[model samples]
Target: MRIDVHAHLWTDGYLDLLDSYGRTDTATQRGTGAGATAQELEARFELNDSAAITHQILSISPQVPHFEERAHAVHAAAYANDLYAGVVADHPDRFSAFAALPLPHVDAALTELARALDDLDMAGAAVTTDVLGASLADPAFTSLFEELDRRHAVLYVHPSGHDAGTPLIADHHMRWMVGAPMEDTIAVMHLILAGIPSRYPNVRIINSHLGGALPMLLRRADDQYQWESPQTPDKPSAAARRMWYDTVSHGHLPAIRAAAETYGPDRLLLGTDFPYQNGDLLRRAVTSIHDALPGQDATTVLDRNATALLNKA
Candidate 1:
């Protein structure tokens, strides 16, 4: 079976849920529409006639940073969890959900994290690369990471293009084109160099967009930090090299092949940034990976590997 581990869905009544948070810009306004719920996503699937896509995991867009204040952030996370729970409940067979957490608010995020996992029965939680410019490896957020590691939480790393110097919006077309991947690369780098893998070994991070320029810079990141100077500890940076990436490169055959060659098959997962890009494009991208690899390697890349990562097995 085909399992698309990376997909998003937003409910029509999401506005009502967000009404209390005050009027704020959403992912929809940004043209990515990463905030759409499962109901909206289902409709899109039908409209696109993508009936072949059977099992999918639904998550929210991490691009929209809502936790400016601690109170607002907690409320926003609670509401998102409630809404996503309802989405999974309504369509248990068709979709599973990842809980959205408010970062930088460790205590509040910890409480909501437990609630989402224990009470809401979510697969895991989605996290931005950083919280208000602070990297995920910051001490303020270490408890949440520790808890997630203990609970065996899958931390989906969705970069928010939040860097101030090169604001994604400043570049106009470069926002998602260049900015998204750059932000993701920075986030992953921080997680790796800060020794997150060593600290939280159980935390499974899903790096979106084929690990966001990581494949291209694998040699640079690994090579430069091999000895680990003042920037990194005295250790090889193989942990960063060993990460889970998705196949949402938009039908780029060479990129997909190169990623598999660099990261290997087991590290690759099935991802289709559906409801943002065309579903057909996702299908083609996945198929390209399968075609590139031979025998069980292709099978593992297409579905087996994703199932193991998402714990759908």
Candidate 2:
């Protein structure tokens, strides 16, 4: 059985919140499979039956509104969390959910996280790479990280809107294809450089899209660290092993192999990026991993790692 660690759902209330804030990007405009019906989910499951995906953990996509006004962001987060709670309640066997926190609004996010995990019983929290242009490693987020550490919360890091001046691959309409993963790479690098994994040892972080470009660039990062800041407490690659990564490389074999090589089968978990990827692509991605890895290693990625992560939470 496969336990897909990454999937997304959008509720009308959540979309309305984004619209109210004028946060309509291409993902939002297209709705990006957020409002899929129960029947649609079942159909998707049937389509992925070949992959044996028995469970999916749903998170709000990165299209979240990082409101400049803290109150609005908090309210939006609460609404999204409530929506996720309802989905989990209705499909307890087939689905679990992660909470959306109004990040950067550190105190409010902490409160909502407590409510989501303790009260709503969410699987964990899903956060974007940055919170209103602030990196996750910013000093302002230390309290929030501490709270997550205290609870031993499972934190899923996804890419958010990019603030780069010019879009990469804009002509190809693959901003998401290129930019999102780049953001994930940057975010993970920032967290590692700032020693987040070592500092928050108890917090279990699962970075999406095979940890973006991290697997490929980690050696370079380590070399740079050795040359630039030899005084740092830990090596970038060593700190990375303490974290987990999901197999959402969109069926890119080289990327999957790189992640598997760097993180190993134990640290790798299966992910679908559902709705965005749809069932066929999801199945293909899983198949690709199976093809690339040896016997039990593929099975470990498909089921064991995700089961372990969920059980840990």
Name the best candidate (by lDDT).
2
| Tens-digit lDDT string for candidate 2 (37-132) | 776666766855767888888888586646878878898899888888887898787788889988678888889999999999999899988887
Screening candidate 2 with a backbone cut-off below 3 angstroms (N, C-alpha, C), the clashing residue pairs are none
State the TM-score for model 1.
Answer: 0.87
Give the poorly placed runs of model 2, Cα more than 4 Å off.
Answer: 26-32, 163-174, 229-231
Cα lDDT of model 1 by residue, 63-164, tens digit: 332566888778778877897788678767777888888767778888888999999999888877667778777878888878988988888877665542
Query: How far off is residue 111 in model 1, in Å?
Result: 0.2
lDDT of candidates 1 onward, in order: 0.71, 0.82
Model 1 lDDT at residue 201: 82
